[model samples]
Target: MFSRLIRAALLAATPLSVSAAPVPANDAQRGLAALQAMDARVAAVGERLAVRGAPLCGDRQMRSGLLVHGLAQYAPAARADAAALFGLGDAPAVLAVVPGSGADRAGLQAGDAIIAVEGDDVATATAPQGAARFDAVQRVEDRIEAGLADGALSLTIRRDGRERAVRVTGDEGCASRFQMIPATRLNASAGPYVSVTSAIVEFVASDDELALVLAHELSHNILKHGARLDRQGTSRGLLRAFGKNPGRIRATEDEADRMALYLMARAGYDIAVAPAFWDRFGRRTGFGMFSDRTHSGRRDRMALAVREIALIRAQQARGEAPTPDFAGR
Candidate 1:
């Protein structure tokens, strides 16, 4: 909801394996960690969907802004196998890219090793890839973000041993960014950025459900719901220590719910999963429809999603693209 992932490649110096009997508890933790890393692919799906859908729905009300290279998750690799897959000879490799995004338009193909940025060797910008690939990825991301302010960035892509310098433009969307936090809590929230818990990532049944959740938080970003609430003077004192204003929170939830489904529709995700997720989410949390002050009941949210999805389908049937109704929201 807030930002993204950089699925980079890594070269395992040697395969780490152990006997099955009497394994250490840390082994389970390590297994879970690896699963979490791979499972996070869902975040990229949400990003690509949002990149495509949100702008289409909101022309001026929202903006056709926020250009992205659409690359997600990257890592440094040295092995010939890694080099072959990433299309680089021991360089930074991309994991995924959003279709039709600024990066896509610039021909910044996924898996192309970004060997350099603006003539500066990208490898020099990143941290030493000692034991973990993430360390290297972090350095590259920092270098990449530093270049974002330049409005346009030159990336050196290596494919089949040939290098090409591609320049990509940048655009602004909502002020919100994205982050995936480490927690098992099956929920997401947004303000300056969309924050999705690791728990939510593990809990979702499919990419469709995950995208719906992401779109909901991304919707909060697009609508500027958080800033608007703060502007309304929803107390920042003990009220914050307690909980948010129920009325204000509920209103924002309504808007987020509506806009999220349309985003899913435009992104080509199955909106049918939206309501199902809420039904499962509410039941697991023991939160009732009309019972929570900050959110509508599960039944209410799901029903609304259903209605809007149908409306979206009808619009498409009529050969008209549905736009987010931001009149009051």
Candidate 2:
């Protein structure tokens, strides 16, 4: 979340050249540290979920288990400061490498700059002239995805100012990418990407609670709710809250909630935390009440989680695999 403290820090920490002055203990430095810490936590949790929930995802893909960020992701006003402090370049660079992941096994390290993917020159891509530009990063990701789809994926990484080829035979995992956005909103969303704001990450009490959030978003993607809503002719604007659209949206949310518990259980997280976390989130954020017209109320969501948890626990007790109940399944 972009807190007042962080915003104030960002303002105080204006962009400067690398040769300007020795890096001081400023708000920018502190903010960068905080952001990197969040990145690490999100990458670790996301990698675990991707691996553990792969069976549920059904259609697995080759995943490198790397979290990347570039200078372009920073505000234009803060890019120089960020680059000076973090040694980040315009090319997509590794921010975190999941432990025991393909990237880790391939000897990839944080700060490694990816110049090319599968022999394609990704570094040559034009750098966008603004803050929060992800075109370059997404280009590299597209290349990697295309390469992996064909067969093995290879990367040319620049580390210690030396470029070398790294052959990456990635692990099979869910197709979705996990991302942590810098925002003040305590919210998350899913389509091809499962994104959680820094606010929600900070709000979660523990990894178990965080798993509840991630699993829910992951379920939405696995269920293809966004695409399904389009197929159902659901509106994306204010009309979404009117007529039958709210019911249709709420149906998907309910399905995702139910599927989320199973995902948590499959990932070996404590399913018992689901109900309490949703209740607390609902009360604290008013997320399921008042202005929220497309979601079940706090009470209904909590009740559904409780019921699903019971089923999951029963299956666990009987030495059976916990699974979600799809329609007619």
Candidate 3:
């Protein structure tokens, strides 16, 4: 759990893709708009999984299906343009509201500026100089998480040049946050949060494929793989690819693969998409120096997914829930 937490923290602080490369003012505006569109797509799918996967998670939290961005999340060069483009202030503002979510039902809309959470002032939130801009927005997210824990939330928001109080009573969801890291890398990670890169978001052919990736990461969190590895004396550093660590890491990876299918099926995603997607990802992008050692090979992963899909099909044929067997897992 400690390792997972650290990984997520560091990843969130990493510079976003828009900030990774320099562009002209107009180009920056387009980039920010493109990033928000991607964020909205990811938020929609994530909201669905949060509600549907609640049964698989032992821990639960209120899910509002709200995604926010602030002026601070942009690079210094892009901040001014971003502020004008999005009408953002120092406070966190809504970037997207998934349709049918509690936030949407409560009349929350994109561009609403968050002022306070349950009467606690957050309008002056600021990130430290020379630090990741997300740090400031993350503080607001932390407060919102705490407020939602009480089963409901009251927010003061600025919209249409006016301020109003909004009450949000969200649905209970799996205790995990899904985030999109605006980077070009085709990678994803799981811990307290499940995050995917913007590149992977665009790489996926369909939401079904995207669900396969997110579900795999979310499965790692649900299964407590990080804590389990930490207990087994596994190293999270370079040494992780050496000694018994490679096998240990591969084992968790394999387990996450199996669990991911069931997670998707439970969320009403077609399990049939798993095999092909894994095979493509493995053959095309799964080979890295350490990745080769810490993960199952393409053929092995595909075979496992095929078998799991069969089991899921059998259960569905019998009118039973498609639950993954956790016998030795």
Candidate 4:
């Protein structure tokens, strides 16, 4: 009797695994159908708005390349990669570099277009598909992995349409998983690291907007919001475990916004555009519209971001040395 009682208690104490029961096909289908419906609605709205040349909120799309360029050490090469991957190779651009990684230490800057890699002509390569860019990057990585024990590689880059060659030495101590992400979604905290999502770069906008986005994300890393989140997790315990407490989540976002504003201003970007970008997509409304999971309500978050930008501008005007744009420097 006692053994049976103990078994019951143990069972009661065990948490239910989310995967224990597989999601039903019907449920999955319903979710997909809902998404398709939303997509159709958005498309209709877009069609109507296209006539006006801009949506009600202006353009909801955030230009992310500017942010990536501001954060990257080798801006030219990164821009080339982004352009190549996004089928904009003919356009001048740069891609993002992982923070504290080899690229960061080698003085590689964002906004630098990679004209060549290790003397190989990169400009001739075909535009990359979603995974092709990764494959191309891996090929270079494989070369390093194969025999470049010296941890050095040569890169030919173009900055503001001027070509130059620079040598980058790898650092194993640097974290490998860090990514350059846009500032718009710079709120998600993933343990010791913060998560950033990129915006699709549109042809109509200048790259400066993209740089601002990157600057904002880099600020989040500089401020060390991830560590704070971890501490909050420990303190809150079960509340966090059950997702009942949103305090830490909200705090991290607020801190990131504040930090991003400082970083953008310091990077020599126009602060006015930061608010302008949000103003374009700040207020989006429609029922059965895009699910809340993919995007935050732009207006509410933009308001917070604007406040932070104002404070940062005030600080900069006071002559406080601006924060460095690069991470791990």
Candidate 5:
């Protein structure tokens, strides 16, 4: 007993491992994390948006397996080697498989590389030199979308050097497309497509809040905010180059928020959490600044969200279709 006690004491006296966990991330790790998070969020938000936004936007044709690729526009390093990108995710990988999605049900996983769609090779049938990382991948997606235009799609995904054919039935929904980009700025943009920064995706507290952001961005597309700004002669390059024209930007923001209230409501997302998100998000370290040159004040944003919600609620109570007031834009 004495000998055991002495050994235990000495063992306890030894220094613990100097771990680097819970420390600052190097640039590479930070970049990888941002990209990975973006892909994961892409899978998640894409699934959610397809389900909710499709019904609201009136796309309702049928479902594409929630299969995400690693070589999308934002993360191109995956094209370097099949394995390297696969390590980050699957090479040209299946980044995420949404729960209960067609992909999920079809037995696809995160580390599967879609080698071929139908009979054609996914990335030129083999990797090419000096090609844009996402070129062939884009072609594969395009082919799948087109093939699905009239019917189903069949894919052969290679995992661990083994290939298995998976058939996907594509359902058409909203016209808006979704993309994930690795950016630190809390910025998301919408056109025919809605692209959200990985930062905003990781920052939001819940999917509901994320939907709020996406809904607002989608509103920009729904109202053609960028095109309208152009029509109004608001210089886009100058506005972005130097934070000029607060009034025009503020008007667009107000319009987006107003339309978002109705859009998100129709999509069955909780607009109530929106006020709370705007309340906390704007006060963050890199956010919530009182910028007169770009966005409106926090007070104005908060008030606008609340006002829109009230108006929507009143409209709902009156048994009237809550039409978005995008008049005179």
Candidate 6:
């Protein structure tokens, strides 16, 4: 009986392995060499695009203490696409509050469940379109700006099952500019920009998931992987510059995977979710390059992401400090 119970417990704890063949050693080496060359060429291009002495945190002059970093506010219905992907049910409630923004000062939390906005029943409102979400919020703001409301907009919320009314003042901060671009192929050396042939930002599972993706991309920028690859050698640079390279792209992707894991954790997103996101993405997209110019097929990319997540879990088990907030005030 004891043995049977132990076996069951172990089986329950095991993560299922993805069935896919690893890239061949020779192929891997060639890919790595190609990646190095691409990195050098990309670095040259990035250097030209790099804005000198740009402050990490731009001027914070919003009435709301919130700083938008690569993100934009939308109505609850506009976020339906993401909500469906996350399995948050048909109509999940969403609320936005920047750390130092008016919403924060007015006492709003990230996960706050909003019941009503300015006496309108949010739950029953029409499902918002992509652009309509921002439009709705702007309408509320316009009312305030035109001196229609007293001082604060009335918001009814259900937190921990209890109903409460809160007043929120409108203020602004840096607009969040994060977006996901889909492309048949992209130059890894492009620096901080991921190209998508066709994609939509609203497809992400959650705001946290969106943040995780952006954080990972930002990690590449912070680590200077492009510059590091440039130091690797010459032939690699030539291929990457002309965008005919495949190997170097794979190497840069691997580095970005590792870096993204670190960045997401630090950004306070559930680190485990990152792997799950990639796994789903792989299933939908298939294993291999999107096109010949793309490197690191789906199988390899998914596997590497899983490995990184495991490393993060191990670090957490050792009682490491949580990732600090990289989004500055």
Most TM-score-accurate candidate: 3
Query: Where does model 3 exceed 4 Å of error?
Result: 1-25, 127-131, 289-292, 327-329
- TM-scores for all candidates: the values are 0.64, 0.88, 0.89, 0.40, 0.72, 0.40
Total clashing residue pairs per candidate?
15, 4, 0, 30, 8, 26
Cα lDDT of model 1 by residue, 220-275, tens digit:
76777768878987653335323557678778888888888777777788888878
Q: Kindly list the per-residue Cα lDDT of model 5 for residues 1-329, writing each as its tens digit.
A: 00001000000000011231112145444444445445555555555655655544533434564444443323234333323433323235565556555566677676667777677766433243342344544555566666666657778888667888888765555556566665566767776447776668878888778888887886776667777778877765535424445667667877887777776776567788878787777777334333434666566778988988898898889996556655732
Candidate 1: give its CA RMSD in angstroms.
8.3
Q: For model 4, how does the per-residue alpha-carbon lDDT over 224-254 read when each residue is reduced to its tens digit?
A: 5456666555333334423523555455445
Tell me the whole-model lDDT of each prediction, alpha carbons only.
0.56, 0.72, 0.75, 0.37, 0.58, 0.39
lDDT of 6: 0.39
Off by over 4 Å in 2: 1-25, 126-128, 287-290
| Candidate 5 stretches greater than 4 Å from native | 1-38, 55-67, 70-91, 123-133, 239-246, 285-292, 315-323
Candidate 2 clash total? 4
Q: Which segments of model 1 are wrong by more than 4 Å?
A: 1-40, 56-116, 120-152, 156-179, 236-244, 287-292, 326-329
Tens digits of per-residue lDDT for model 2, 193-226 = 6777778889999888888888888887788777
**Where is the poorest 10-residue window by lDDT in model 6?**
6-15
How does model 2 fare in lDDT? 0.72
TM-score of 1: 0.64
- Candidate closer to the true structure by TM-score (higher is better), 3 or 6: 3
In candidate 6, stretches whose alpha carbon ends up further than 4 angstroms from where it belongs are: 1-198, 230-244, 283-289, 322-329
TM-score of predicted model 5?
Answer: 0.72
Spell out the clash pairs found in candidate 2.
1-183, 1-198, 1-199, 2-183
Compute the lDDT of residue 145 as modeled in candidate 2: 72
